[model samples]
Target: MKAITIKQPWATLIALGEKQFETRSWQTKHRGPIAIHAGKSTDKDACNDSWIKSTLAEHGIKSYKELPTGVVLATAELVDCYKVETTVGHVSVLSNVKVVEGLEVAFGDYTEGRYAWELTNVQVLAKPLEAKGQLSLWEWNGDSK
Candidate 1:
């Protein structure tokens, strides 16, 4: 399956549904079932913020420092890719996300981090492979099976 490698805490945030948008600097034309791969780089400063902590707390989420990086944490189908609208009356929509089974992921690159990357044979952890919840699948990739 195709997967996009994302930097640390953001990936965690996305997995936990703390942050919705993946915040891409550029736009993507591809949309489909993609693996949420967490990278080794983490935002250390943001990790200690009260807002972040509080938000997670409200959702009853605990510190995820124990979770490994550089692997796919969860899978979601990308419905569409669009630019962030900062204007009024505009809501960033991931559209129709379908959360895949949650899995414990490792840290490291299967291939150099690049756009539109595909992966196979990566280790999908047996534990924590339960469905935490559902998410929007913005873009359809025809891999729902």
Candidate 2:
């Protein structure tokens, strides 16, 4: 499947459902199964931040110990994509994704970055694997890149 690499902490946030908006500088016209590849990089300070710690605690994230300096934690599929309604304008959300492989994820978003991935399947490639958090169309047939 095609993938888009993401930085650390942010990647973990997606896998854990902490920060929902997968902020991208551009918007995608392609819609289909996209892979959530956690990049092999980590922000130590982010891992220890009070907000993240508290959020993980609430979510019962037990793998924090394994989040090393650089590693891909998990992988997921964006099964569905949509434009969410809001006060400002519609934003994207990948809805109803299955955490097929990695840790259990459950978070929400209300920003323009990104809300959810319509996850159809997931593969926990590694708790701290050497990969990148990337998202991209699995066999993009669309004209937009």
Candidate 3:
């Protein structure tokens, strides 16, 4: 399966169903089922945020140390990729969106020119399979059955 390596907390947040979009500085044309790989690096600063911390706590994750890394955490459909047009005040209005605010905005960087990969039908693995991460989209050799 095709996989994308994402830094921790963000990867876990996506797997936990709290985050719906994965923002990137780049964009892709591929649209299909994609594996969500949690990279070895964790964004400690992000993990320390009160909102992120509380959200992880809600999922029984006590701290950043407890987040899984070097594993494929979940699978989701790469439904859409929208370019962030510009920010109207604090909220971003996607080129394809009229206005986007709230948690969706909080979960990602809505800076103009970035891309938001819309993920849906997320299926988190009960036992995450170990896998080394790579930059951008790469192929995962593991059986996702």
Candidate 4:
């Protein structure tokens, strides 16, 4: 399967279905099954936000260190890629959807020119599969890198 590496706790958010659209600097043409890999790098600053910290805590992740890394957390379909048309304060205008407010706003970079990769049908792995992650989309051959 194909996969993309994302920094925690974004990866964890996606895996847990707390966030639906993965924002990117560019658009993609590929649309199919994609694995969600939690990269080894954690955004400690993002994790420190009160709301983010609380959300993670609700999921039983009390510390940023407890978030899984270097592993495939879930498999999801790359359903659609939308260009972020504009934003006013908190709402991000995508091709056919709008991210209104709250965590959807807080969890992503809603800059006007970014692409939002819509993920659906998330299937979290029973246990995380240990694997090294690569930049952009990559092949997951069921082994550690």
Winning candidate number (lDDT): 3
User: Number of clashes in model 3?
Assistant: 0
Per-prediction TM-score to the true structure, in the order listed: 0.54, 0.48, 0.93, 0.93
Candidate 2 vs candidate 4: the TM-score winner is: 4
The TM-score of candidate 3 is 0.93
Model 3 regions lying over 4 Å from their true place: 143-145
Q: What is the lDDT of residue 20 in candidate 2?
A: 38
lDDT of each: 0.45, 0.47, 0.89, 0.88
What is the lDDT, from 0 to 100, of the residue 84 in candidate 2?
36
lDDT winner between 1 and 2, please give it. 2
lDDT of residue 21 for candidate 4? 88
Give the alpha carbon lDDT tens digit for every residue of 1-145 in model 4.
Answer: 8899999999999988888889999888999999999999999999999878988888889999899999999999999998888877768888887554667777888788899899999999998999988888889976555
- lDDT score, residue 117, model 1? 22
1-145: candidate 1 lDDT, tens digit per residue: 5566666665665666554445444556666666676665666555566666565566565565744565557666665543332221222222233221111111111111211222222333343222222232232232322
Estimate the overall C-alpha local distance difference test score of candidate 4. 0.88
lDDT score, candidate 2: 0.47
Q: What is the lDDT of residue 4 in candidate 4?
A: 94
Ranking of all candidate structures by their TM-score, best first: 3, 4, 1, 2
Clash statistics: count for each candidate: 14, 23, 0, 0
Candidate 2 stretches greater than 4 Å from native: 59-65, 68-129, 132-145
Task: Name the runs in model 4 displaced over 4 angstroms.
Answer: 97-100, 143-145
Per-residue lDDT of model 3, residues 47-117, tens digit only: 99888899999999998999988999999999888899987655888766656777778878889999889
Model 2 TM-score, 2 decimals: 0.48
